[model samples]
Target chain A: MQLDVSHISIQYQDNVVVDDVSFQLAPASLAAIVGPNGAGKSSLLKGILGIHPLKKGNVYFNGQTLSSVRPHIAYVPQRESVDWDFPATVLDVVLMGRYPHLNWWKRYRSIDFNIARKSLEQVNLIDLADRQIAQLSGGQQQRVFLARALAQEASIYFMDEPFAGVDAATEKNIVSVLKELQAGGKSIMVVHHDLQTIRSYFSSILLLNKKVIAFGPTDEVFTPERIQQTYQRESLLL
Target chain B: MVESLWADANARTVIVCTLLLNSAAALIGCFTYLQKKSLTGDAVSHSILPGIAIAFLFSGVKDLWVILPGAFLTGGLSLLSIEYILRHSKLKQDTAIALVLSVFFAVGVVLLSYIQHHGNGNQSGLDSFLLGKAAALLSADIPLYFSVAFVVVFSVLLFYRPFMLISFDRSFALSIGIAAHRWQQVMVVLSVLAIVIGIQAVGVVLMSAMLITPAVAARYWSHRLPVVLLLAVLFNMIASVMGIIISYKYPSMPTGPWIVVCISSIAVLSFFIGNAKGILRRSSLTVQK
Candidate 1:
C-alpha cells in the first residue's frame, strides 16, 4: 500500500522541530531517511507512524489514515535506545511483535512460533533464540529486533537508526533480509546516519533537518553537495 | 509482664493479620517494582498520615471508611502533582519525589503533634497508624486487604499488554496507538488504593517498604511479569509473617518496622543471589562462560 503525507508540521512547545513536509511512497518502496544528530529524523519517523501529535497534516497508509491501519505496520526501534539488559529471552522479545495480532487471552500458536523461528533464521539467530537479550553482542541485538519485525509480517516497516553501531557481518545480514522482504513486496522506511551507504543500500532518501530538505531516488538526491550540507561540512570550492 | 500476661487472642489475631497484610503489600509491590518506582511507596505512605488527620478533622469520625478514602485522595493528588512537576516544570523526578515526600510527611508530623499535645479525644489508634500495631488488626481488615489485592491482580491480568508495552517501551506503545495516559492513570490510581488499604497493617510509616521490598526480592527469581508478581507476593507474605511473629515474641515492637527490616534483608539477599542480574549470579555466569 502507498503512503501519502500532506503538509505536516511538528513543533515541541515553541521550537519548530519539523517544518511543513510532504511526500508519497509507492507500494513496496525502500526509503531511507538520513541526517545529522538533532535534525529531527526520529521525530519525522514518529510523526509518520502517528506517534507524536502532528502540528498540522495527515498521513495516510494505503489510502487510509495511518491510525486506521492497525496491526498492518511494524516498528523496529534503535538498539541503543532500548534496555536490552531487561531480563527476557530473545524468543520472548520476538514474541512481543505478535501481540497486536493476538486477541485477548490468545497465545502464540505453533504457526506463530514457526514464523518467529523463520524470522530468527532469516537473521541467522535461530540458534540463539532462547539466549537472554543481555547476553547478546551489539549486532546480534539489532538482528534480534529485525527478527521480531519479521515475525510481525507487516506491509510497511519503519526502523529508527537500525545500523548505528554494528559489525560488518550483522549489517550484511540485515541488508540481505531486507532485500528478501522487498522481493516479497513490502515497503521499508529506515532512519539512517551513514552517507556512504545510501547508494548501495536504499532506493529513496528523506534528507531531514527539521524539514524535508530533499526527497527522491538515492542516486539523484544523495549528491556530495547534499551530504556535505546535511553533515554541515566546511565547504572547500572557491 | 502485665501486658504479656494479658496478650492472648489479640496476639494471635495480630499474627494472622500481619501475614495477610504483608501478602497484599507485596502483591502491589510487583507493579511498582516493574516500573522501577519502588521508592514511591515510601513517599506516599509517609505522606498519607496528614491526609488521614485532615480527613478526620473534616468528617469528625476518624473511621477507616472515611479516612482511608481521604488518604488515597491525598496520595493520588500528590502523584498528579509529582507528574505535573515532572512534565512542565524543570524538576527531575527524583527531586520532585523528594519534594512531595518531605513536604507532605512534615505536614503529617505537625498534624500528629497537634493531636498528641492537645489530647484530641484518645488518639491511641492514630499512633498505630504511624508505626503500625499488627496486633491491632481486626477481622474486619482481612476482607479489605483481600479486595484490594483481587482488584490489583485482576487489573494486571486484563491490561497486561498495555501496561507491559508502556513499561517496556513507551515510544513503541505510543506509536501503536496505546494512549499510555489512560492505563498509567489506572496504575497510579490502583497504587493509591493499595496504599490506602495498606496503611492499617503496614502503617503509614512503613507502608511504602512493603510495596517495594517484595518486588526487589522477586527480581532475583524471574523477569517475566507474571512470574515477577508471583515471586514478590511470596516474599512479602514471608516477611510479613516473620515480622508479626517476632513482634509478638518481643512486646514494645512496631510490626511495620520489623516487616520493613525483614523485607529489606530479603532484598539484600536477593541482590547477591539473583540469577540473571545479581552480582553473584552474573559472576557465576561469567565463570561458567
Candidate 2:
C-alpha cells in the first residue's frame, strides 16, 4: 500500500521537464497533484509509470519495484490521448482492464467478464455496455475510462485529468468513486485541475512545479501562500 | 463464361494468387488503418524497388525467390529509417514517410533504368513491377505466395489481441506490461511481408490500394474490430474475383489495376451507402431530425 517516488527526473532533448522530483503516499490516501500548465505534472506521472523515459529516478510500492508490482497498479490516461472512434464497445474497453492478469494465449474467463460488467455498473454505464464508444459524449467517454480503471481492481490508481472537460454529473460521479476507493483502502493520485475543489476532493495535496513544492495533508499543505509559490502568481481567488 | 474461365489453368492461377494476396493484404491492412499508418504500406511498396533492381543485378535473373528477399531488406530498411527520423528529429510522421518514400523510390528508379540500359534481355520484365503482371505469374510462384500469405494470416491470428490493444491504446498496453514496442515491431514486420508479397501481383504503384481500400470500406460497415476485419477480407476477396473475371474477359486489361479498381469502387460505394457511418445513413438521420 506504500508508494514512494525518489529522485525522479525527466528530460526532453536536454531540457529537464521533471527535475529531481520525490514524494511518498500514505496508505489509503487520495492525493491531488496540482500545478500550472507546463508544470510537468503529466510528465512526472508518466515518468514514474514508465510511459515516458526517466532521466534518473526509482519508483517503489510496498518495497517492491514498479515492474514487480505492475499488476496491482492501474493508470487512466488523459481522454484526449486515445481516438474515441476506435471500434470497440464500452464493455470491450472495460475488459481491457483484465489484460494484465491474463497470459498470452489465455482467453478472458467468465470472472473477467463479470468484473467488467460490475465495473460498468459501478459507473452506471451498464446499459451502455454494448454501445459503440464513438457514440458517447465527452463526460460519458471519461466515465468509460474510469470504469476501465475500476475493472483493473488495482490497489493503487493513477489518473490524469479525469475531470477535464467533463460535465457536472460526471465530476460528481468521479469524486464519489474516488471517495469510495479511499474507503476501500486503495491509494489514488490524480493530476488535477480546478483549484477550487482540491481541499474537498483530496486527502493529501502535492503542489508541483517540475519538482515537489510541498507534500502533506490537505489542511497543512493547501495554504494560500504555498499555492502562490507553487503557481508563481500573485492572485487572490482562494 | 464462368465455367470456361475457371477451367483454364492460367486463369485459375491468377484467381488463386489474387485471392491469397488481397486477403492477406486486407487482413493486416485493418490494423494499419486503425493505427493511422496506412501509408506505411505505400512507402514500403515504393521503397523496395531498389532492392528488386539490386537483386536482379546481383543474381542476373528475375527469379521470385531472389528478388523477394531483396525487396524485404529494402522494405524493412525504409520502415526503420522512418522510425529513426521520427525519433531523432522533430519532423512530423507524414514528412518522414514522404522523405523516405521519395528518396528510396528515386534510387530504385535509377537502378531500374540502369538495368534496363546495361542488363541483358532478362531485364525486360522488371518494369512490369511498376504496375504488376499477374498474367506473367508461373505456377512455381504459387507456393511462395501461399507460404507468405499463410505466415501473414497466422501471425495476425496469433497476436490478434495484442495487436488490437496496441492499436487502440498503446500507452495503456505498455502500462499493463504488454511490450508495446515489440508488438509494434511485429506489426512492422507484418506490413513488410504483406507489401513485399503483394508488389508482384499489384505492383509498387497500386499495392497500397490493395492494403488499405478494403479496410476503409469495411470500417463504414461495422463498429467492431473482428467484424471489420472479416468484412475487409470478404470485400477484398470479392473484389479479387471480380478483377480476375474482368481481366479474363478483356485479355487487354491488367489484373492488378482491375483489382485496385474493383476494391476502390467498393470503398467509394461504402462511403455513400454503408450501414454504419455512410453518407446515406447520416443524411437520412439528419433529415429525420
Candidate 3:
C-alpha cells in the first residue's frame, strides 16, 4: 500500500500552522518527519491520520481516501497525551485496538484475546498482561502502545513521538520492531525529533518547518543545508 | 425506636426504593467521577430545581411523569449551556458550572416560594424536594423508581464498552470512527435521567454527594472500572439501607442527609483501609522503607 499526503494545510483558529505540505511513502519503508520545535511535525502526522480537518488537500491510502480504508490504517498517539492512571490492564488496552474489526455488540472471543496476547508477546510484556497500565515503567508503557498498534493489524502505521522519552534499550527495541514490520511489508511513518538517529533508523525523511522543506530518500534529503533550512539554525550541522 | 421502625410494613417499600435510587446514582457516578466531572453533578442537580418548580407550577401537580421530564430538560439545558460557555467564551468550566448552577437554583427557589405562597393545595408538599423525605415515598412511586433503575443498569451494561472507550481516550475513540460526540450526548442524557430520578429521594443539595462518594470509595478498592462500578453499587446499597433505618428511627431526620452521612463514612473508611490502595497500606509501606 502507498501512503500519499498531498498539499495538506492545517490551521487552528486564525493561525495557519502547517502550510501546504506533501509527501508519499511506498510500502515496506521506514520514514521520519523531523524538524525543530514548533515545526508542525506532529500536526502533519495528525493531518495525515485525519485526526483534524485539513485546511486544504487530501490524504490517499492505496488510491482511496483515508475514511474508505480506515481499518487498514493505525495511529499511535503521543505517550504524553494519554492519562497514565487510566483504570485498564495491559491486555485491556491492547484489546481496544480490535474494537473496530468486531461487531459493536459482540464480546471479545478467544481469537481476539489470543491476538492481543501475541502482540504483547512481541513486545516482551506478555507476563504483564494483567498489570494495571499505571504500574508499568515509561518504556513499558510505550511498548504497550506498540503492542496495541500491532494488534490493530494495520498495513500503514502513523506514530507520533513514540521515542520521545523512552530509555536507550526501548529505543533499540522499537527500531528493531520497525525493521521487522518493514520486513513484513508494513509502511511506517514516525514523527521523530532526534536528529542523531535519522541516518541510521529511517530510509526516507520529511523535513518540515510549517511546510515541506524537503522529502525523499535519507541520503538525498537529509543534507545539512536542508536541516539548516528546516531548523533555521546554521550551526545545527556542526 | 428501632423496634417501631422494624414493625412498620411501609418501611420495606421505602428501603427498597431508596436502595434502587442510590444504586442508579452510584453506577453512573463512577464515570462522572473518573472523568473529573464531579462538579457537573452538582451543577446539574442545582439547575434541576427550577425545572421541578416550573413543572409543578404549570401542571398543578407533583406527579413523577410531569415533574421528571421538566427537570431532565432543564438539567440537560444547563449542561449544554456549560458546554457552550466552555467552547465559545473565556470562562473556565468551573466558573460556567458555578454560574449556571447558582442562577438556575435561585430561579427555582423563587418559583418554589411563589407556588408555596399562592398556588393550589397540591403545591403544599413541594418543599420536601428541597431536602428529600424518603419516608413520604408512596407505593405508586415504587414502580417508577424500579423502571428508572432498570434503564440505568441496562444501559450501563449494554453500552459499557463504548462508554469506557470514549471516557478513557476520546481522540483514540474518534480515530476509530466512533461517534464520540453522539455517545457523549447519550451519556449526558442518561446522567440527566439519573439526576432526575435521584432528586426526589436525595434532594438537590446532597445529591451530588450521592453521585460521587460511592464511586470515590470504590476507586480505592480496585484499579479496574467494572470492579469499581460493582463496589460502588454495593456501597450504595449498604449506605441506603443504613440511612433508611436511621431516618426511620429518628422521625425528625431527613433520609437524604442521613444517606449522605452514611456514604461519607463508608468513603472515609475506604480511603483509610481499602485493600487495593489505602492510606493505611501506603503509610505502612512508607514506614517499612
Candidate 4:
C-alpha cells in the first residue's frame, strides 16, 4: 500500500500550524514525524489522520482519499491524554478497539473477546488483563494502549508519542512490537521527539516546523540543521 | 373512609409518574457517569428553573408539555455555555465547570424567587417543583415522562458504540471516522431529556444526584461498561423503591429528600461495604499487605 499527502495546510484559530506539507510512504514502511514543540509535527499527523481539518490539502491512502479510508486506519492517542483512573479494566479498554467493527446495540462477542485476548498476549499484558487501568505503571499503561491499538487490526497505524515517558525496557518492547507489525506488511506513522533515535528507528522522516522542512529517508533528514530548525521555532507544543 | 383515601386514583397516578421519572434518571445517569459529565448534570439542572419560569408565562395552564421544553432548552444551553467557556478560555475544565455552575444556578434562584413572591393564585405549583412533591403529580403527567425516558434510553442503545468511542478520545475517534460533533450532540440531547423527565418527580436542585449516585455506586461492583450499567440500574431501582416506601409511611413527607437520602445512603454503603472496589476492601487488603 502506498500513501501520499499533497499540499496539506492546517490552521488553528487563524494561526497556521502546518504549512503546505507533503510526503509519501509505501507498504510496510516506518515513518517518523520530527519537529520542534510548536512546529506542528503532531498537527500534521492529526491532519493526515483526519482529526485536524486541513486549510488546504488532500491525503491519498492507496490512491483513495484518506477521508474515504476510514476502516483501514487505527489510532493511538497520546499517553499524557486520557484519565487512566476511569473505571475500566485492561480488558475493557482493549475491547473498546473492536467498537468500530461492531453494531451499536451489540456488545462484544466471542470473536471480539478472542481478538482482544490475543492482542493482550502480544503486548505481554495477558497477566494484567483483569487489572484496573489505574493500577498499571506508566510503561504498562503504554503497553495497554498498545494492546488496544493492536486489537483494532488496521493496516495503517498512527501513533502519537508512543515512547514518551516510558522506561527503557518498555521502550524496547514497544519498538519490537512496531517492528513486528512492519514485518507483517502494516505501515506506521509515529510522531516522535527524541532526536537521538530517529536515524536508528525510522526508515523515512518528515521533519517539520510549521512547514515541511524536509522529507526523505532518515539518513538524509536527520541532519543537525533540520533538527535545530524544527525545535528552535517554538518552546511549547500547545 | 381513611383507608379508602389510600386507594384513590391520584395516589396511583403519583406512583406511576414517580416510577417513570426514576427510570429515566437511571438511564441518563449511565451515560453521564461513563463520560464523567456527571457534574454537568448538576449545572444544567440548576440552570433550568428560570427557563421554566419563562415557559410558564406563555403556558396558561401549567403542564409537562410547557415546562419540559423549557427545561430541555435551558439545560442544553447551560451545557453549551459551559463548553464554550472551557473551550475559549485559559481556564481549566474543572474551574470552568465551577464557574458556569454557580453563575447559572444563581440566576435560576433569582428567577424562581421572583416568580414565587409575585405570582398569583395557588396555580404556582412551581415552588413544589423546587423540591419535588410526588404527591402533586397528576394523571396527565405519566405518558409524557415515560415517552421521554423511552426515547433517551433507546437513543443510548442505538448509538452506544459510536458515542463510547468519541467519549474516550475525540481526536482519535475523529481520525477513525466517528464525527465528534454528532456524537457530542447525541449526548447533550439525551442529557437534556433526562433532566427534563426528572424535573416533575425529583426537583431540579437534586436531580443530578439522582443521575450520578447509581453510577457511582455501581463502579464499586463492576469493572466493565455493560456490567456497570446493569448494576447502576439495579441500585437505582432499589433506591427508588426504598424512597417510595418511606414516603408512603409518612404522607406529608416529600419524595425528593427521601429519594436523595436513599441515594446518599446507597452511596455511603458502596463507599464502605462494597465488594470489590470499596474502601473497606481496599483498606483491609492494604493492612494484609
Best by lDDT: 2
- Interface DockQ of candidate 1: 0.44
Model 2: lDDT of residue B226 = 90
- Misplaced by over 4 Å in model 1 are A232-238, B1-20, B120-122, B286-289
Which residue pairs overlap in candidate 1's backbone?
B41-B208
Q: Which parts of model 2 have CA positions greater than 4 angstroms off? A: A233-238, B283-289
Q: Name the 10 consecutive residues with the lowest summed lDDT in model 3 chain B.
A: B280-289
TM-score on 0 to 1 scale for chain A of candidate 4: 0.94
Q: lDDT of each prediction vs. the true structure?
A: 0.78, 0.89, 0.85, 0.79
Q: Write the per-residue lDDT of candidate 4 for residues B28-127, one digit (tens) a residue.
A: 6877877788888888888887678778766745688888888777787888888898778888878877887788777777877877777766446787
Cα deviation of A135, candidate 1, in Å: 1.6
* Order of models, best DockQ first: 2, 4, 3, 1
TM-scores of the models, in the given order? Answer: 0.92, 0.96, 0.94, 0.91
Determine which window of 10 residues in candidate 3 chain A has minimal summed lDDT.
Answer: A229-238
- Docking model 3 quality class: acceptable
Tens-place lDDT per residue, model 3, A92-177, is 99999999888778999998999999999888889989887877888889988999889889999889899989988889889988
